[model samples]
Target: MYDNEYFVVDLGNCTTTGEIINNLSLALETLNHTGKSIVLKLNDNYLNQSQLLSIQSLITSYGCSLDTIETTNPETIAIVENMNIFVQKPIEKRVADKYDTQEEINSFQPFSMPKAEEKKDIIALKDVNNLHFEADLDALKRQQESIDISSDLKEAGINPKEDFHTIDYQVSSQYTRPQEVLNEADNFSKSDTAVFVQQNMSKAATMELEKEFENAEKNSIGVYKKAYDENNFQEDSWEEVDFYETATTSPVISDSKSTTYVNQTLRSGQILESEGNVVIIGDCHPGSEIRAIGDITVWGVLSGIAHAGMSGNTNAKIRALKMNAVQLRIGSCYSRRPDGTNIPYILRSSIFTPEEARVVDGEIMLFKINQN
Candidate 1:
C-alpha cells in the first residue's frame, strides 16, 4: 500500500466533511513518508465536473503533474458541435492560438438548442474551500427527483429513471513510453528501481496507441470476412425446383381452396387463372381466356373464350347461355364448338339456359342463373 501511494482511493464514507478530511490527510501522509506522490485521478461516473475539480483542488497542496483530474458523463447530445478537442486543452492556456478570437470560444452556439440545465464546468486550481460534505448520493437523488421531467426527454425515449452523474477518478503521474524505457534498460539495471521509465509519455502517444489498436482489430475482422465470402458463394446441399409456366406457385396436384375473384372484365387477350373457384361478373370478351384449376363462372356476357377445371378434371364444365364463346373446357381437354347450333341467332341464349351452367350427363348444360 505504501508503494501504491498514488492509488485510485475510494473513501467509502467520505459523505461527511470530517471523514473527507481524515481520509485525505491519511492518503497525503502515506505518500509523503514513502518518497512517492499522488497527482491526478479521474472519475466520470457519479459526480458532476465542477464538483470533481473542486474536490481535487481542495486536497492538492503541491502543484504537480497529473494533479488536475476532470470528468464527464455520457450526455444525450454535445453542448457545442464537435467540441471534444476543446475539452482536452488546458483551461487557462492559449485559446487565441487555437481560435481566431476569444469571442469565438466564449460565445455559445446560438443555432443549437438551449440546454435544460446549464453545466458549469468551472474548476478551482488555486485555493481550497474547506471541503464541505464530500458527496451525498441521497441528496443527489433528491435533487434529480426535484427536476421536472421534460417533454422533450419523453420524446427522446428516456424514462424518469435514467440519470447520469460525472465523477472524478485519480491516476498516477510517472507516465513512460515503452520504447524510451527499453533504450535505458542498461541504465535501469544499474539502478535499484524494479521498473525504469526513461521519459514521460505524451497525450498524443496515448491517442495514437488507441487508434492503432482499433485499426489492427478492424483489419483482422476484414480478412476473416473475405475468407468466408470466397467460400460462401459455393453453398453445399443445393436443391433445384421445377415450376409450370402459368401455375408456377401451385403444386403438381392441387385442389381449389376457398377463394374469390372480383369485378375484372376479362377482356380480349387477357386470361384469368386460379387454384380455387373463380367468379367473374363482367364480360369474358372473345379471344380472352379464363381458366380456374377448380371452377369458373361468368355473371355478365360470356361472349369470348372461357375455360374451367384446368387441372385435368373432365368432371369440371363450362356453361354459358349465349354459347357464342369460341372456347370452353372442363379439365385438361378444351371444347371448341362453332356457332352452328340447333337454335337460331336470337334464340341462342334460350336454347342454352337462363342462368346456371354446369356439366350434366357427361357434358355442359345450362339452368337458371340463380338456380345453382
Candidate 2:
C-alpha cells in the first residue's frame, strides 16, 4: 500500500534493467511523487552499482528519496547495501508465508497502483481501549440484573430464627448535687446584671435621613434643577432626536468602489490601504495601519490604527468585533483612545459586542450594534 508519506514501486515483473528503468520512470512521471519517500521492491531483478545510481538520481530529480529496497537477489542486495539504503525481503515472500497455496497467494493483492480509490486500504493506528471498557461495563450490567435481592429477602423472612432472647433492665434514680453547690447557685442568681439591645432600626432611619440630606444638598447646589430643565426642554421639543443620531448628515454619498478582502492577520509595522471598502477576516495588531476610502470592517480584533473614509467621506464607518484600536479616524477627524482607557491587550472570548465608529459632529463616536 502506498501510504500518504511513503510510496511503494513494485518492479518484480521487470526482468531487465532497461525494463525496470522504463517502468519506474513511467510511474514517477504519471503520479505525484513530490515530498514522498519511495520504497523500491525489485524482487529477483539484478542491477549493478551504475544502474542503481541512475535510479536513485532519477528519484531525486522528482523530489523523492529512495528509502528502502526489497529484493531477494544477492547482487541487488549488495548494490543496495553499498549505497547505504535499507534492504528488506520482497513483499511477495511475506505474503507467500501467510498463504499456503500458490493460487491463494496469487489471488491476494496487498498493494496496487497508487490511486485515490486505494486510500481505504491505508493502515491507520487507533485506540481500542474505549471499546473494551464499554464491553466490561455491559458485562457488569448483566451480572447486576441476574441477582434478585427482593426474592432472597422474602425467603429469609419465611424462615424465622429461634435464637432470640430478652432481658429485664432496671431504671436508675436521678443524681443529686452537694449542699454547697446549691447555695452557690442561689447567690449567683441574686447578683445584679446589665442588658444591651441592638439598635438596627435607628441605623436604617439614619441612612434614610442621610439620603434626604443629600437630595437637599443637590437641590441647594441647583444641579437637580438644571437636569430637570434639560429634561423638560427635551420633552417639550417639537422634533425628538435619537441619542445615536448625528447632529449633521454624513458626507459620504456613494459606495460604488470595489471592496478589498484581507484574510491574513496584519502584524506590527504592516500597512494595508485600499481605494474602496476594506474587510479583514483576522486581527490587526498594534502599530499596524489600515486605510480605506469607503468603509472598513474587521471580523476579528482591531488594535491598530484604522482610518476609514481616507478620501474624506465622513459617512464611512469603521466596524470591528472587538474595538480597542489605539486611534480611530473617519474622514478628516481622528480620535485616540481616552486617557486611562489604554490596555496592553484584550483577552479573547467567544462573546463579542461588535461596535461601529464614524464621524459625528466633527468627533468620532462609537456605538454598540445590537445582535438581536
Best by TM-score: 2
Q: Per-prediction TM-score, please?
A: 0.27, 0.32
Q: Over the stretch 22-92, how does candidate 2's per-residue lDDT look in tens digits?
A: 99989989987687778888888888899999999999999888877888775676567668776665654
- Which candidate should be chosen as best, given lDDT against the real structure? 2
- Clash count for candidate 2 is 0
Task: Estimate the lDDT of model 2.
Answer: 0.61
Superposition TM-score, candidate 2 onto the true structure: 0.32
Q: 122-233, model 1: which lDDT tens digit per residue?
A: 1231123212212232454477579866766778887534332111211222323356555554455423222221211122124344545554532110000001112222
lDDT (C-alpha, whole model) for all candidates:
0.41, 0.61
Report backbone clashes per prediction.
16, 0
